[model samples]
Target: MSTRSHSAVMLRRNFKHVARNPTSVFNAVLMPIVMMVMFVYMLGDAFSVGVDYVDYATPGLMLMAVCYGLGAVATAVNSDLTKGIINRFKVMDVSRGAVLTGHVVASVLTNLIAIAALVAVAFLLGFSPSAGLFDWLGVVGLVVLLGLAAGWFTVALGLAAKSPETAGLASVPLVMLPFFSSAIVPAEKMGPGLREFAEYQPFTPVIETLRGLLAGAPSAGDAIAAVAWCVGIALVGYLWARAKFSKRA
Candidate 1:
């Protein structure tokens, strides 16, 4: 079978696994909504971002949804590795790209679903965006780009982890990075030492670009930086994952 065909087969198998075990889905989907409610209700009034707390926070939450969803990708890939699923596929002549592609695409799809659900809840919470058709398209494109990049990175983490449990733990940084970002409040609101860090961290530009798109006035500089970060991470992740898979399988 062609790589595409092999990838499709792997994709189906991965989805089946997800269907049987929905823990990751809850982590990726429900956890963000919980956080959203917590932020917009329990904690929103404490901040003074220029816009509605919901509106300001929605973009950040969307980015968090992507970051938070990566644990599943790592865990799923680790499960396959430790269970000798990849070794079995190796004997059957399955391509490495096919295996990882299945995880990456599936991760991206699940994250999109989570984002959609989050957006729905955001609307219900009085989150209103100035984005138009093009703006929405930009949002999707950027989210997918980030998802693809982070998916591969987490897949590499899974490959590198000692076990499935460790793989879940390995993804903690991705989950935590957004909190330190402009997600909950404006970066300027943070104290001086932390503010500088928040301004330059990878997630910041991406979140800012996303916020800009939703507001119908995205910054070109931020978009450039965001794309550059995504591309660099994806390349590093693909190469690292390929090397690890080659050695193991």
Candidate 2:
């Protein structure tokens, strides 16, 4: 079979895995909603600074949702690795890259759905921002890129893990990354050391870009930086995962 056909078959299998195990999807959607609610109701008035906290926070929550979805990818990949599924595939005539590609594609699609659910809940909670059609499109594109980057990175982690538990633990730092970024609060408000780290970290520029796009205040620099970070992460992760897979296989 062609590489594309191999990938398509694996993709279908991954989707069925998702269907059989729905908690990953549920948790991906739930974490952001719970965070949004807690932040908006519990701290919105204090943190909003005269603007709508929901609007100010929703972009960050969306990004966090993407991060949360990575945990699922890691878990799924690790399960397959540990359960000998990958080993079985190695004996078959499957395209070498198709297995990982299938997981990445399915994880990206799942993340998009989680993002939509987060946005819907945000709107219901009074999160509103002004953005043109093109802006929205840009936001979606940016989000997909971010998801791809993060998903691949998690796939690498999953492949490297000896067990599913280790894979889940490995992704904890990714979930916590946005908290240290400009996602939850402005980096300027942080201490000097932390501010520097938060400003320069991978998640910061992406969060800022999303915020800018959704608020109708797009920044060319931030957009460029976000895309650069996503591409860089994706390339590194793809190479790392490919090498790891080959070595193991």
**Candidate 2 steric clashes:** 0
How well does candidate 2 match the true structure in TM-score terms? 0.96
Candidate 2's displacement at residue 48, Å, is 3.6
Model 1 reaches what TM-score against the true structure?
0.97
For each candidate in turn, the TM-score is 0.97, 0.96
Q: What is the per-residue lDDT of model 2 for residues 1-249, given as tens digits with 9 covering 90 to 100?
A: 899999999999987787677687666767778888898868888884447888888889999989887777888898888898888887887887999999999888888887888889888889888989999999999999998899889999999988898998999999999999987788998998999999999999999899999999999999999999999999998998998888876
Model 2, residue 153: C-alpha shift (Å): 0.7
User: C-alpha displacement of 160 in model 1, angstroms?
Assistant: 0.8
Q: Which ten residues in a row have the lowest lDDT in candidate 1?
A: 16-25
lDDT of each: 0.91, 0.88
> Could you tell me which residue pairs clash in candidate 2?
none
Our model 2 lands, by Cα RMSD against the true structure, at: 1.3
Q: Point out where model 1 deviates above 4 Å.
A: none
